[model samples]
Target: MSFAERYGPWAVIAGASEGTGREFARQIAAQGLNCILIARREGPLKELAEQIRAESGVECVTASVDLAKPDAAEQIAAVAGDREVGLYVNNAGADPNGKRFLDNDLQNWVDLAQRNVMTTLKTAYLFAGPMRARGRGGVLLVNSGACYGGSSFMATYSASKAFDLCFAEGLWAELRNHGVDVLSLVLGQTDTPAYRTLLAEKGLPLPTNWASPVEVAKVGLAQLPHGPVYNWGQTNDVAGYAPNSPDQRRARVLMIEQHSRSTFGDD
Candidate 1:
């Protein structure tokens, strides 16, 4: 069966204004699923919608709203209207300033938590219900390798990603019997605009292992049937690492500290 037929006729891609999210919107539209693109930036979202409509001839709706807002999920649902949204790509996430935990103000941490954790939770809760009722659907939660363990300069960011990783895994188990495929998309360094800007700001070179957003999106979508968890580029052996071992944990912390200092000049 075609992807649209198997899942549903429509897919909602959060954070679809640029980068991997844009690639997801394009690819899903190519697969014949109408797309609802959500992002904070209206210009980019409208441009992407136009491009998708022009290229794939698929219907596209753009929602301009900050996912960090508590009611983002409801707003997205309202834009989706009565469409059978079969696939939801929860790609929107907060980017933390690469600074020590104490360096950031309390409100910054709160905002990051809301964007990364609360919004994702709300989106899943709102979308998954309809998917379950329909008996066939998919949810892709975009996570990061930072989820493996505590990151020194990225403590809260990593914690939020860990939440996403666990949430997706648990949902996969619970929803499998209901014919809803849930995937935790564990990404390594990707060559996205935001990542590039970060590198430039830090005066660091791009990592050789960086995957293109297009490649990541392609692999992620194709591997939906194989999930619970899919790690993009396999850059980190997250599954093989023994986090509980004292020696390994110590080594991991040392590595993170050294890398953080070297890359971001964080002590």
Candidate 2:
């Protein structure tokens, strides 16, 4: 089947206002799927929706709900209405406060968990169930290189992203035979608006060789069927116990999964 036939009718993209999320909206729409755009910023979402409609000639829906809130999934569903959503992209879970764990407010970490962990899990449960029944759909969880290991100032962020990575891997195993694709798109130093803003706040200049959001989005969609995980750049491919090479990680997951199935009899 074609891309649209396999994962289309409609695709819901959280964090759809800008950067990689915006590019995902564009790329997915270009491939013939209508889009439901969700972000806390209403203006950007509406602008993107209009652009997608005009450019791709596909229906566009917009929702301005904070993904950190408990009712985020409900708001998204209400916006989506009864559309048979075939793809769900969880991309709203960026770490806003790039400070030491103790330097940040407790509430900030909690809200981060709500956005990155709780909301992601909720939306997966919401959208993936129907997709599995339909037998052809996808879930792309945008993740970070920090997930590979802990960092000095990225404690909670790293931990939450690790959760996302493992969750996607497990989901990939469960849904692979059911015709639902799941990917953890792990990124490193991408040139996103959010990254620029964070750098500006810290009085730092842009890096010379950051990954492009457009290319990242393109590769992510192309690699959806081959996941478990996609480590976007060599920044993640290191010589250590926790190597972040996509092929290595994929092999490890498959190996462990085979062992589990053999031991537990695929119950």
Reference-based lDDT, each prediction: 0.83, 0.90
lDDT of model 1 at residue 257?
54
Q: Model 1, range 1-267, lDDT digits (tens) per residue?
A: 678886769999999998999999999999899999999999999999999999999999998988888788789889988888999998888473777789989778877888889889888888899888878899998888788788688999999999987788667766776888888887888888888888898899989978899998999998786667776654233444423332233345456556767777742
TM-score of each: 0.87, 0.94
lDDT of model 1 at residue 204? 94
TM-score of 2: 0.94
Task: Give per-residue lDDT, candidate 1, residue 41.
Answer: 96
Could you tell me the TM-score of candidate 1? 0.87
Clash counts per candidate, in order, are 0, 0
Q: 146 in model 1: Cα distance from truth in Å?
A: 0.6
Per-residue lDDT tens digits for candidate 2, residues 14-55, read 999999999999999999999999999999999999999899
RMSD of each: 10.0, 2.0
Model 2 residue 202 distance off true place after TM-score fit, in angstroms:
0.8
